[model samples]
Target: MKRLILHITVIAITFVSLGTYSQNNAFKGYTIEGDSVVFTFDVRDYSKFTQEYTGQVLDFTDFEIENVVVSGEFNLWSRDHWKMNRVNEHLYQLKKSLQDFDDEFSYEFKFVINNAYWAEPSKEDPNITKAAKNGRKIRDVYNLKMYTAFPKKDGNVHFKLKGYHDARKVVLAGSFNKWHESLFKMKKTKEGWELTLQMKPNIYQYRFIVDGHWMEDPHNTNKTPNEYGEYNSVVDIKEYTAFKLRGYTNAEKVILAGSFNNWNEHEFVMRKMDYGWKYVVPLSGGKHHYKFIVDGEWIVDPNNEVKEYDGNGHINSVCMVK
Candidate 1:
């Protein structure tokens, strides 16, 4: 009886361990980390395919991979633009920033082997999608699943509208989506409507469309006048941009000034770090020109490469916000 009880306890523990492993490692071919998206292609996840041009069946194993590249609409479907790094015998991976892609719900792409054959998902797979060109479907070409990633952490923005329970649809349209009327639909909640987006730091103007009627956000008082004799809601989604002046530890004071603040010399005092002086400030979209004032001596940013003339025959460092 003692031996039987010990055996039962071991089986229970084994099942629990297996269940936990299965839940955590359900491979999805991709992972999103904040602003970066990592695309992974595992040979074991796909099935055998026949090369249409060569009429040769390709069986992918750990030893069969020569090279792999990711082709998609973002790169005009080029066969060799974005190459993947081999992580192991069967895994090929590539990483890209969110800024590298245009604003879209999803994108279609496939992996290319040896820059010749396309690695496709099986028809039964949910990631499999038909490829099309010029509004016509292509034959014998299947793409992997639509892949996309959203920014997390500091990039998340939430918008809500209250007391529109009877409306059929509430859409959030703004400069982010080029003011498309139906692209971003809000979900109805117990309170009202809500939609969250991962957006870069910038100033944007938006309005809510409730059942085909457009109106500014009632709950938000910040607004700007539009040409149509109405007001549009405004939100400044900003990120902290850091400016540093290295090797200036002995300076009595350091100030940060730029085009964002009309070159005010008194604002944005820099703090001393271990290496040098630093200051972080929130900024909106577009280009800004700035310099560091160390001991009241004006100098351009030594670390930044991009610079431009300020029309007064003086050169200033430039920082672009996207």
Candidate 2:
């Protein structure tokens, strides 16, 4: 059941032609510094008719644009099926007719401004706990990747993300070109804060707000993952190792007597295939993270491939483990 094309009058005519959105169409804009960028996005809420269908079809050519500086290839014309994604991260590829194909769905492209989030959902915490709720008045957490039209040459793509206790600065937005975030910040070395971005590969999702919370990329590579089970905010500048593989079912095989290798059938004895229990873990290719544990009592991961969040938080599932 995978066929849900998008086309709602090319997203209400580009929101009446980007009238009131800043940053060159900023619903949270981004365009990192030229060399290529003419992409557009809008999928007017999508549609569907009944009674033997009415009239509306979609197949937006082959939408593709990539991460890690310089990668873009575009083609979407079911009357311009609303476009974006034409990647080329320095020959890593995505433009050549959209690197063949491997399909997935849930494509909406109208942005009212949602830089998606997930900063510090617990990278183990240790002693660093951000996320608040006392009086509640803090927003702006968007750290995305794909920079380096020579951010310092040599395939650069580094970062630091120091720990802030009271904070005043720390911003990095996503989608490569929307939500530009002060032309790039995050440098404070001596082995604590570094910043680099020279990309052109593919795969990106981002988050990070610091003072007010919202974070990810404890390393990088944990692409989209959201729904009810959260964690879907990414960043993949490319070394690859972002784990986001989930699929479960009625899994419960325990015995718990004296504790065998079974350890009470932990992780449901590992499944991942028979069309249900599957969970892979590893993230660094570009970082973002979220999940759900169930029986043990950690929840989220309702199958959200990245709608965008960090504001209305909760409901996570995202990975980065090649």
Runs in model 1 with CA error above 4 Å?
1-31, 40-69, 84-92, 97-155, 178-183, 219-232
Q: Estimate each model's TM-score.
A: 0.62, 0.18
Off by over 4 Å in 2: 1-73, 79-155, 161-171, 174-176, 180-196, 200-209, 212-322
**CA lDDT, candidate 2, residue 33:** 24
Model 1, 33-144: lDDT tens digits are 5456677888877776546367466765553668888877778777689999999987899998767875443566777778777675667654455665512222357665
Q: TM-score of predicted model 2?
A: 0.18
Model 2, residue 187: what's the lDDT? 49
- By summed lDDT, the worst window of 10 consecutive residues in model 2 runs over 11-20
Candidate 2 residue lDDT tens string, 190-216: 434445444443344555555445555
- Highest TM-score model number: 1
Give per-model CA RMSD: 13.3, 23.1
The alpha-carbon lDDT assigned to residue 162 of candidate 2 equals 50
